[model samples]
Target: MSVQTFKPSVRVGNWNEDISLDEDLLKDFLEKREKGELLLQKSGRLKKCILQKVELSFSKDGFLHFGDVIMLLNPENSEESLSNPSPIYGNYTVSVNPDESALSSKTQLTAPCGISGISNVKPCARNVFIITSVDGSDYGEPLHYGQNFALRTRDGFMGHLYLTSDQKTFLKCCKKSHLQEVSLTDQPSYETCWQFVYLDPQLRMENEGVPVPANTKLLIVHSKTNRCLAVLRKYILWTFFGKECEVTAHTYLNGHKAEENENHWIIVTGNPSDDINTMFDRPKPPSEEMNENKCIVKPLQK
Candidate 1:
């Protein structure tokens, strides 16, 4: 039996208004690539070419700048997203094997909403898709190649990704996110500064004998309520690793030590503070002696 062939669409924001991968668009993209408009890695086991990286600007000039972890694309041939067998009633999830390559390299995929009907999206130009290497005999496709990565069509609009490696990708997909383009001259946006929170296991353990180490960085912001804290953790795990990543909670800040886990990233305090609370709290007022001869703390608490 012949496998079904589907022509991929390159619509700006939808599949229906598809534009054929004409010469003009490819020419423009190639010119931009050579102009250093995109990050280009010269060496790596995986072919390195960043289509785009999340960037923020703090300058008044209106120019933009991107952060690290250049968005690189896989160089493999086209592949399809995993299809579930027993489509009517089945239980399954995408399970990635834990290994260096899978962990080191990741991609995130997003699809347009309001599906008119069942569909298959072809690869976009230079973009990659994640797919199972094996086929399912029962499901009409061969079974048992297991999960793997493959490149999207070179000129297709960004479609579903195989793995995602950063928070920026999640923000792009979340509709409720209050995304705003800050003026270049205004306070630098989240894109400009590296976000890191100091974890001090000793402090947390001092309050409670929990062994959570404070040496690691926790990027997800915590809250006063347990619900919020749990949500933060859940969000972090889902945002980057999803079900594929293994996440551990730390009690202290120790980014310097994790330098070896280059694949791992951290968020820590940017300014100086004796304690994490003070780092997060407002500045303290100066201490002074009152005319009544008693020591007084300025800005008395209400």
Candidate 2:
């Protein structure tokens, strides 16, 4: 496979405010330097300055370096810029444009050009499962997999979810092995792997020692992108009821949060009958069966 390269525009700003290095600010800073004024404030100081345009690059080290200063790119907080007091001494939002190349490369385990074996690669699991809504009235449309991965409340069947090896992209009803030439197996060659990441720290603390409810709202993160999965709802005539619903990965913290609906999605799980053994398969124990129920999918509560 060819290594993909991404060059996203990076912006820095205050965490709690919409402050960033605007053209006016940059120009003002230049004027101050020409006047021989001090750049450092008593509390907050301008640590570094950029003069001419320089080539910016990102690596697997998770830091965007320009000259002597470095910005920490925390995967846990993938959507926002973090505060690094040593280099840049304040809260800054280091925003990266969510282009395909940049997104695919960032989520990979190694550099795009590095020689990482397949095992080291984090590919989306290929599994056929149902995305059941929490209200128990609707399901994702399997037939619409090629179109938008639409979901509806009535007359919809189970849709198979698949993830690419990079884990940043998603596909429907496709096997990773089929996407790449590999061996065959009686078991599913691909699986849809997902998890609920807590959005509120206080909510997490409050629910400590208590089992999380099935209806809890979470950011469904794909293992590869470390970003949230969101459904893009638009009008479509081919859907179960002529309404189109599509799923896409989003980086809302990067100032694009308002562009996408972060409030959607509840949980994803297998069909209710997934635990029962078929004629060709052996029955799993209750404990094992319960583990399969973790795929929770539902609409966000109003």
Candidate 3:
């Protein structure tokens, strides 16, 4: 990605009437600057100097920086509406919401509020990310266990990927073991814990009395009587009785369900540091170890 260059047009007038910079004002001011006759300063000390018809430059990452001039708006003025006519010549931060329309750059302006010269744009405290897993088997869709696909957000602020459909099918593929020893009459009791980590813009709980979210993925499996204590110790906290407990789960605060559970769990995150490396370090089995050699041990009867 490359950087964008913009030539800003300047205008000199009592721009306090409206917050917008019309085409006429922009053309007049820019044409003057080209001829080296544009005035940089105003006559009256109390007169407001506002920037109009300005073209903003952005970095490769879509972050806006740099400015030509700035003006301080009267914070006490109630008649001025900053939402409609954002005060020119000042720096402000913008927040991104999960809603698709919130990322639009063209109609970013909203109706004028009571405040003058202030922008309606507010800083975002946290970024919303979603992960959805699809169980292709249930829908007649084959699992692509070893293969994965990637996706991106409209604004380029977020991205993620999951196993290809065919790869999931490979997970279910099986081979017979060579062991001839006598079969154990009884299997140990099944008990394991699983963690469902995801983002919650409102940080609201999915169900009542549930500390985490609802329908969280059950990833861990344990043997009855605690025979497989090694795996149990690693993921013990995610279990309640003899089954996987639902910890923090996905609850898309924007009235959207951001989770998918097709055979495997699909994790989504907006944290700048969240990535494949971070997920790999978690409790889930490595992609390589998910081969046919793995066996599904049943829980022992109580």
Candidate 4:
């Protein structure tokens, strides 16, 4: 039963006890009772947090400013948001898994939301990021086209965006995440630097030092490899964030040239306290996306 369903034997106004209960003790008991069945949410626990969903327009200066707490919205064409056989169920206690990658996490069963929608699940660290320079500079600067910058996770996970160069083929997918971990703050590495390729060459819209707009679609290229950031749906992994398309930096050679790859992404940002949410609507299956299926827990697709 939920704590809200419980009631004290003594009524709120009709209390007739001769020996009164200690106020402090009463408060402690109630607090513990509330937390007893709590399911910890890293992003949800934020004393203040904003959940930003995708939209064609934005309320912030349409142009994105540096040092913004941002989240990258994967392209819908990537099929990254499609729900698979398994879907996130009700309330869960997310826990760290020692066997998985040190940065990896998993969801432990706790409460059931009773709803069949993936929308109800709490977001993982994957949904939060920050845009900063390799050094501590550029906090309030506007981002320019094709300029070098570092993207870092903002949810306290603390990983920098970087290219994974240790693969067999130089052109591998980017798990470095939105190019993701390693601290540029400690020492700048070329692997973590990335450049934004404008969507249209004709307009050269923001090339001349204009800030990239929020909710604007553009390509993310790793500085070292020139490989664009992409999500390989075929490379889905069951992560702490549920089944998600694997992040990679590469241009496929199937038909078109490297530049033809679908690597467009949107950066959304805002402060939760300002009524702007850090939580955006995650991709959900078209049909009934409920806890009907079990979670496919794995570190990576491979």
Give a tens-digit lDDT track for model 4, residues 1-302: 65665456545653635225567668767785576422343324321222333222223555665676565655343232344433321121111111122312233211110100112223334344456676455576777777788765443333333222322233432333333211223234676687777765544554645567665566777777776765444543454435544445665443433244346565655434444343233333454333211122334445
| Model 1 local distance difference test score | 0.22
Stretches of model 3 off by over 4 angstroms after superposition: 1-127, 130-265, 269-302
lDDT of 2 by residue, 175-249 (tens): 222111111111222222333455553344454333223322344454444455543222111311122223344
Each candidate structure's TM-score, on Cα atoms with residue i matched to residue i, is 0.17, 0.26, 0.15, 0.50
Model 3 C-alpha lDDT versus the unseen true structure = 0.21
**Cα lDDT computed for each candidate against the true fold:** 0.22, 0.26, 0.21, 0.45
RMSD in angstroms between candidate 1 and the native structure over all alpha carbons = 25.1
Give the residue spans of candidate 4 off by over 4 A. Answer: 1-59, 78-124, 135-137, 155-187, 204-208, 252-261, 271-302
Over 136-212, each residue of candidate 3 has an lDDT whose tens digit, in order, gives 22321221211111111112222121101111133321112111111111111111111223233133344222322
The 10 consecutive residues of candidate 1 with the worst lDDT sum are 224-233
Misplaced by over 4 Å in model 2 are 1-191, 201-210, 234-237, 254-260, 268-302
User: Residue-pair clashes per candidate, as listed?
Assistant: 44, 15, 31, 21
